[model samples]
Target chain A: MTPETVTLILDIAITISLVVGAVFTLVGSFGLLKLDDAMKRLHAPTKASTLGVGALLLASILGAFARDEPSLQEALIMAFLFVTAPISAQFICKVNLHRRSCMTPPEPSSDSTWATLDTADAGDAPAQHLTPEKG
Target chain B: MSFVDYAIYGAFGAVSLAQLLAMVRLILGPHTADRILALDTMTVNAIGLIVMLGISQGTQIYFEAALIVAMLGFVSTVAYCRFVLRGDIIE
Candidate 1:
């Protein structure tokens, strides 16, 4: 096969792979919106998007080789992405959970005010004042 | 439109829409985790975009950049998560 023909085929294949990867990413993003909770939302992007990017990267390597260029740099990029994205997501989630649970103690003055308000409200209520008194 | 190009464009359109939805989550999320997840999703999609760009341009540099982004994004997420869980960065 001629170099020209090989290049054409590689181009077609790479295009197809990249488009599929993009579609997967889009779906994963949609999952982020549709899922009810953080953990559930985590699933689509991490799993599906990772695979999608991998496909795209593979296509890149193929295209690079077709063009007679070295692909080590591209490979390195993929390696970096694969390693970092998930770990970052995990850290943020853990921080969020911790923040939600940390409770602040009420100030003493505010506590006293609350107590006074409660007692005043309770004292003003008549205890069955409408009932007829027993003779 | 050529069949292949049409398919590629369609995928791009769909993914863009999905990225928008994820952005909404990032903006409206009540908790940090949800926002972080949404951001991660966006980064992953960005990698996909870079791949597409690399393919279209017939170059390898974009792909290399994408891999780097993926690595850095992951490391940052994990580091922040650890910070949240432990409430301390050292020891």
Candidate 2:
């Protein structure tokens, strides 16, 4: 293939990736807006948005290669996002659980309560010292 | 403009629309968790926008901005969750 053909192919790939990324991002946000329940809404951003950004980053990487710069720093962003997306989702889930904002999760057969819901005895962990004293 | 140019423009419009939708959610969200989720989604969309900008301009400078936004967004989400869960971010 000629050099022009290769450049054309790369450009097509980058464009396709960009379009896909944008569509996913829009769908994710739309879900976030229209989902009936909070927990359901949580699924939209965490899953779809991550995939969207990942696609965009892939396009960025491809674009760099096409431009002859061949930089991989976009990979750093992708890796960070992939690692953190689920973690932040979990944290938000915990927040939802703590606030009782959504349907309560089913009880475990063995455990009396979920760890997040289980209140510790005062003796188990002292909390008195953490409170600020009023003058 | 070529097909690539049209695609780039379309992607920009779509991502910006996504950001606007997330913003509406942030304002109208019934629960704190919903708001937090909206903010998180918006952050992700912002990163998309930055990446798109970088792609269109063929520049590398936006990479750092995107990375920093990602880090800050994660940290802020965790902090918000902590505050909601225990009423304190540190403890």
Best by DockQ: 2
> Estimated TM-score per prediction?
0.69, 0.92
A39 Cα displacement, candidate 2 (Å):
0.7
How displaced is residue A113 in candidate 1, in Å?
A: 39
**lDDT minimum window of 10 residues, candidate 2 chain B:** B82-91
lDDT tens readout by residue for model 2, A18-133: 98898899999999998888889998889999999999999999999999999999999999999999999998887677667788799999979887666675344333244321
Residue clash pairs of candidate 2? none
> RMSD of each candidate?
14.2, 5.0
> What is the lDDT for A69 in model 2?
93
Model 1: which docking level applies? acceptable
Candidate 2 wrongly placed segments (more than 4 Å): A121-135
Docking quality band of candidate 2, CAPRI definitions: medium
